[model samples]
Target: MSNFKITDIVGVIPALITPFDENENFDEGRMRNVVDFLIEEGVHGFYLTGSTGEGFLMTPDERKKVVKVVVDQVNGRVPVIAHIGAISTKISIDLAKDAYETGVDAISSVPPFYWKFKDNNIFKYYEDLSGSTPLPMIVYNVPLAGLFGFDFIKRLSTIENVKGIKYTAYTHQDIHKAKAQIGKDFMVYSGADEMAVSGLFNEADGIIGSFYSMLADVYVDIYNNIKAGEFSKAQIKQKIAVDIIEASLKYDYYAVIKAAMKWMGFDGGYVRRPFNNLSSCEEEKVKDEFRKIRDRYGVEDIRVLKSI
Candidate 1:
């Protein structure tokens, strides 16, 4: 049987960033605090080691460490989806199996990149990894992975235990078509942080985003508003998120977030090598704008929420 029931996965799941120390090592303490903060904020689920989490940069051992830390910290309060994508099929399968054993609610992977392959090969990659673990597998489809379109999604969705796709693009019509073709139960999570409400309008089951790590309450508000048939309110929340995201893009996006987390009194550490940390001047600007974001949104001081 599949490890994760389809209904168990939904809503504003944050694609959590990995906390790293000055020495460029994973910082467990910082990670724990972030997890506690997110759960306390009422985020529906957690997505670890994805693009925003720098999963692509981490070694297999490092990825496993992240999974263990997050899963233990969460302790079944909500679902945790682990992204275990590697360029090699064997590595992806091994990571999938390891994440399953480490207790993630589901596993996700990006298609093979930096090399050309037939559609059949891509399908085989997902097919092998999906069967390697009972945990449901989510396909990460973005332009970076060649944007497996709706028809391909229909085929991929047929894989045993392949539960869904983290649809990262803005093609809402295709998302609508895929849902109609495959039936409503096939999960479609919006990975595009900016157009989140649009995704839901097109019938995405929920949203999984990196920005939600900081503005989860806003995203959750958007989700709840949509569910309550409050489209206008949902659009308002979406605009707030877009504004914050626009501000975050001012510098290195991940670096800005790490800086923002620190400003909020959470233990957001540093980004690893090759991804430059923000310069001091840029960081101050981000902090200044982040405060504006909170002010504009009328959000409470999240730092006062108390860390676990």
Candidate 2:
């Protein structure tokens, strides 16, 4: 297994977006550029093939390939956690094993969804996947998948090799409570980009979110400011991030994220089928708004709104 400790799982990890070419195939060159850019910008780690990476839309083979590419590209510069969660328990186990073979630092999974599964079913899913690989398991507690409350999270924490969680809910209180009740050794990464400061204030070990792919430097600043107890500085950076996120929310979330990446010079291509790209007019509007924010905040080196 990887030498990744639970402590290594902390910081500004991007829920990395998978780049696709015009044909909608995985764009390996773009992917490598993204990996390099984020690392250079000072991100802590990478969480691959999660919701932001379109894991659910990708086939099992595609997901495996993406994990291998990222693992190889990362080359141990930072820890990589591959989100191998699939609808089927067996598929998740298979993906976990593949991720392990490819040298990912850890594996994470959203509880099996679609069909209404009871708590016991979810527990069994985690139990089976955790045993299939030696890598540490980070539970993806996304409330949209169905809220995993403290009791359930506490129970999951008890499982063998289940090291931490990617807590995506807006409830910052749960993060503080989890740290208090689940123990500080249990790593909790805040998955909301807009609440990076609030999450840190509540004692979340780190921040992970979809937007971090485009704005790693901003979140890294937020993390460092929080760690340095520079709350005011962190809040200033957080406000800039919130403005960007709120602007994106005006359009389809994933589509705008991909477009913004392109505007930033990364060009992550379009969101997959069932997720449409922004119209030409919509794209121009987004570009204009980002330009305004960049000038307003005197932001530079962010790669966004550099030129209108």
Candidate 3:
């Protein structure tokens, strides 16, 4: 077994959704249940408080609670990496330290997104974070919600404690360049659910995907088949996995993830404020599509299809 290496944490790492109660508070109990479910479903590890987890939406204390709950439930059974990025290094460092205190396997942080940071600022930010906590750190390189660009990754790689990165960008050149610069010791995780296979082929040690909780069996099967040299089955599994993502994208990304959680047994609910649930009209359409998947497997998925 690969223990605590960055590459060892690869494969089907679910960017878990933060469930909120109707009062718009995080449902900690439901969150624990969700972690248990993913562990049972065969996910490799957790990519907490990231894009899929709506990390930006929660308070620092609330986010820390999510990490603590997951680490407690997992209890050293699997790797649990908490996403610790914040609008400021103070907050990010706080979260990273908390993640260390909570017994998580590692901590990851996205570049500060307040303004377009210079390469030096970005480098200092990560180096500061990597130094702030004892836990291994993976830097997240994404400009969509921020200004840190490809050049930032190249520059940030200079930091010694910067363990690796989560590549969420769609550009293949960015992936190639990061791998080329970071070298084999620094792990690269595929952040796009739809590009897991391509990313894997392109040297993504594993995938950190939003869909892995509900669609985990498919990912596990795909990884297993591919490793077993069953390319045909792996391709078929990847196709189905992509089809599921295509369907989920029809609704809001996070909403559909929560919907999928309910469809399974985890009871993950709608996203908190500023990010709403799937519209009633869209929910029906999603239900029908989910049913198609469930009917084939003969499994009742409450995390994905709650009412049924």
Candidate 4:
């Protein structure tokens, strides 16, 4: 019966992956299983249909279905933030409206890709999208969408419904500066999974990353360790996190994450076209390597991870 407020949107929020069946259709059951898995693992929140979820590649209908299924499966256990960003303001608005009506706790968006829009144009895109719904908006700043400069980020913080920014850059100073410039009430979720310890130590309220779908407990451990003022222990956990991340990156990222999940008995089915899942031989190789990573990091099962 508990629900999270904007201020409560902190800690290990997984950047959830979009599961597809062998036929490349949205596998609702597998998606639902992923939702339930994260919840049981004690994730603090869920970011649906973001980069990790392949939102950009999905049709509007697929995106909506994902949001609906995740929100329904989550059933108010924690906050569900949907990523509704698209190539144009109109599409983003439509997706935003759908996400809002589908009962997401909030909406987040990356800037328009494949074009060099001026700063004002980019600002207007977010402004228009934020105005499309009452749901709070978190600006997603990643390299692919053009990095959001501090000036632009500061301007965005002033937007009426703009709640926060998902900082994905390599610098921890950006997190610190955003907090100082935007004021403490504005939430900043570290989108880089490997830098979670740095983000938390620099005062990021939470973390949202693709890796967390399988590694939630370890990130939660880092969060808790940092919050408890156990920096030494948190540093050790962060090292473990980086190690896991490095292992996953050796292959196709989404493919590797999905394969790792599959290895743990969760249904991370084939990735859609334009991005292929591991072949039989590659899967066997990656699985053998991941097993070592898992054993070293103590990643047994998602369901067994201690909850926050």
Candidates in order, TM-scores: namely 0.93, 0.96, 0.88, 0.93
Which one wins on lDDT? Answer: 2
Q: For model 1, which pairs clash?
A: none
Clashes of 2: 0
Give lDDT per model, in order.
0.85, 0.88, 0.77, 0.83
lDDT by residue for model 4 (1-308), tens: 22556888888999999999988999988888888877787889999888889888899989999999988999988998999988889988999998888888889999988888988898899889988888889999999888987888999988899999899988779889988888888999998888888888788999999998878777788888898999998887778677767866877789877776776668777788798788888876665665676677675543322211
Which runs of model 2 end up more than 4 angstroms from their true locations? Answer: 295-301
| Per-residue lDDT of 240 in model 2 | 92
For candidate 1, the TM-score is 0.93
| Model 3 steric clash total | 15
Clashes of each: 0, 0, 15, 0
C-alpha lDDT of residue 102 in model 3: 81
Please write out the lDDT profile of model 1 over residues 24-68, one tens digit for every residue.
999999999999988887898899998889998899999999999
TM-score of 2: 0.96
Error of 3 at 199 (Å): 0.7
- lDDT minimum window of 10 residues, candidate 1: 299-308
Compared with the true structure, the alpha-carbon lDDT of candidate 2 equals: 0.88
The per-residue C-alpha lDDT of model 3 at residue 35 equals 85
